[model samples]
Target: MNIDVPRILIAATQSGAGKTTIVSGLLAALRARGLKVCGYKVGPDYIDPGYHRLAGGEPVYNLDTWLTDEQTLLNLFARTSQGADVAVVEGVMGLYDGGAGGVSSSAQIARLLGLPVALVLDAKSMGESAAAVALGFRDYDRRTDLRGVILNRLGSDSHRELVSSALERIGIPVLGALHRDEMLAVRERQMGLLPAEENGDRETVSRMRAAVERGLDLEVLLEAARSAPRLSVPSLPAPARRAARLRVGVARDPAFSFYYPESLSALEERGAELVFFSPLRDSAVPEVDRLVFGGGFPEVFAGELAANLGMKASIRAAAASGVLILAECGGFMYLTKTLRTLEGSVFEMVGLIEAHSAMNARLQTVGYVEAEALKDTVLCPAGTVLQGHEFRFSTVEPEAPERFPWAFQITRKRTGATSLGGCAAPGLLASYLHLNLLGNPACADWFLGIASDASDV
Candidate 1:
């Protein structure tokens, strides 16, 4: 199917340039104009998209070039952004920064999807020099469609004027010049911007809308979003095929909210009936053939998670019974023997895996990894070359022994660092890497097939 998607990507010279705020504000501002807006984040980040959805009143999608291939990436954008008046994609880190060689940079996404770009530059400490910086980004890679610029954190009218005129002379349009306003800043925590679910209250959204309305030029954004080339791709992915139905329990709550819509939809497409339950509050694991635990702020609720002895025992019993269980970062921690909080207090976990976890003040690791299964397991052999992402402020304690059976052999894309992760058994696969099943939907097929075969009762 052929479609025309008027899309624009919001990128920054680097992180902390207020791009997330700008993107969120812009989403709110555009939606406030009575336009149907679809929001997307350019990488594997799961936090910014939450703010985007809260700001725009829609389900935000992730467009990760690392997790999903180019075709799958375009297919996702095309399928998700359908029937929207416009779409805004928030970029990660810097424009040209991604996995080594700028593999999945915001600039790369813009080029891949043939979309225009509007850069957000931090102007707190610079004036005319800001133009030089903008010029470098625009010129660094001419292939990227550098359409306009947003000057964030400008100190004054004079500062905005100084930067705008210099940029105008170089043929770059200044779409907006936003003053440094405290009201625009969102709450943040140890990892990054706090997820909107935790931080985007009504007052916060109102404040963000006001800030963007006051400083952003909505007409310029719309114009740039529509100025992109016609969207063309080989073809849309065929619809998912259904098979034997199986009940799959999914743990979802404030503590376990890291699931992607596509990943879950992939399971449904494979004929698995997804049943939502909560490890945070549910006293017992729901009756299902399989269970999945996505990542979230499980460590923040360590005390409550430990307090719920019944829930922990339920999960442990289920895992021990050989029920297929798949978990990511925070979920992986919850499966361990204990979780040591930042305060050094220890809390008992499910103990399904023979390891303990510790919440660290600093981020232990963050990057894209290619995971190769170390042993035969559901979805391991068929989908061994899985693309995954990891970002957490926690680590496993008394790390898995060198000879301990590993679920996946993970190789960091940037540093080539290799490590063994998780426990892989006949009916279990748990690890820190967050896998997008749509990237390799075969995994979902394999996973659901195992769920069906394992139900011999």
Candidate 2:
């Protein structure tokens, strides 16, 4: 299908160029103007999209080339932003940085979608060199449609003017110039920006809206966005039919809130009703045909989780009672016998698995992985290839072969590293790798089928 959707890609010269800050404010300001603005993230990030959804009051979809094919990305963009006034995509790290060969970079997204790019240059403590940075990015790829520039963290009027003059000489439009202000920044931790569910994010968002209103010219941005040409989106086959009625329970709370919107949506598409429970606060797990526990900062709240012995016991009972379960990363750790924090504090968790995990200062495994299910588990059959990504700073301690039987034979997509990881048993599937059921929406059927039929597992 062909559609003319006004869109602009917000990119950075590098990672810390304040593109997320600008994107958040623009989403709020545009929505304030009564325009139905839609936000999209270009990579495998979940936190930034949370803030974008809070700011724009809409679901922010992710566009990644590696996880999904080009046709899927186009179809997602067309469907999600169908009734919106404009679409804003927040780029990842550097505009050109990605896997081995710039596979899922923001530049690739823009180039494939035929959208214009807005280069955000961090101009603090620099002058014409900012122009050199912009020029390098602009000239690095002649096909990149770098339409405008946004100078961030300008110290003074002279600093703004200096950067502005340098860009004008190079015939690039300056959309906005923002002075360095602490109010424009958001609190962050090791996992990048904190989720919008945290306290005080509303006030921070309000201040960001005010900052953009005062420092930026929204008319210019809207005009550039409207200038994006019509795009020819390729149509693909719709997702297959799913199972009959079924109920699925999900563990959700501050400690276990790292689920992909697509994962849950994929389940819903398969006729599964999701029910959420807090493992840290709830006393009992909800009754459902299947259960899913995604990743989060479980170590930070080890005390609360360990103290909730009632919920832990309930989960243990479910694991033994033949309830289908799919636990990944933090959820995988929570199902272990214990989780030892970096501060040398050990917390007791659900004893569904025989292993214990220890938090490490350095990340143990992170990247896209292809796993072959060693045996028929709750999620897939034996020798079935599964696509997923893993990011963790914790690993199973002692790493004994017999104590922790390997479930999947995993291969890292980025480094070609191979390892025997995760565990699969009767009615159980636990791993550190995060699976994207949304990219291949059909995969949800296999996991959901486990809950439907007793003989499948």
For residues 1-457, write the lDDT of model 1, one tens digit per residue. 4447788999999999988888888888888889999998888888888888888888888888788888888878878888999999999899999987887899899888887899999989997899999999999999988887899999899889999999999999988878888877878888887777787476777777787788888888888888877776667555455555788999998889898888888788767899999888899999887889899988888889888899888887887786788888998899888999898999988887788899888888998888888766655562367889988899886455765557787899999999877777557778898988888777786677743343221
Local lDDT at 207 for model 1: 76
Tell me the lDDT of model 1 at 109. 91
In candidate 2, what are the lDDT values of residues 292-333, reduced to their tens digit? 898888888999999998999888788677778889898989
- How many steric overlaps are in each model, in order? 0, 0
**Candidate 1 total steric clashes:** 0
Q: Give, for candidate 2, the lowest lDDT window spanning 10 residues.
A: 448-457
In candidate 2, residue 198 scores what lDDT?
69
User: Candidate 1: lDDT over CA atoms?
Assistant: 0.83
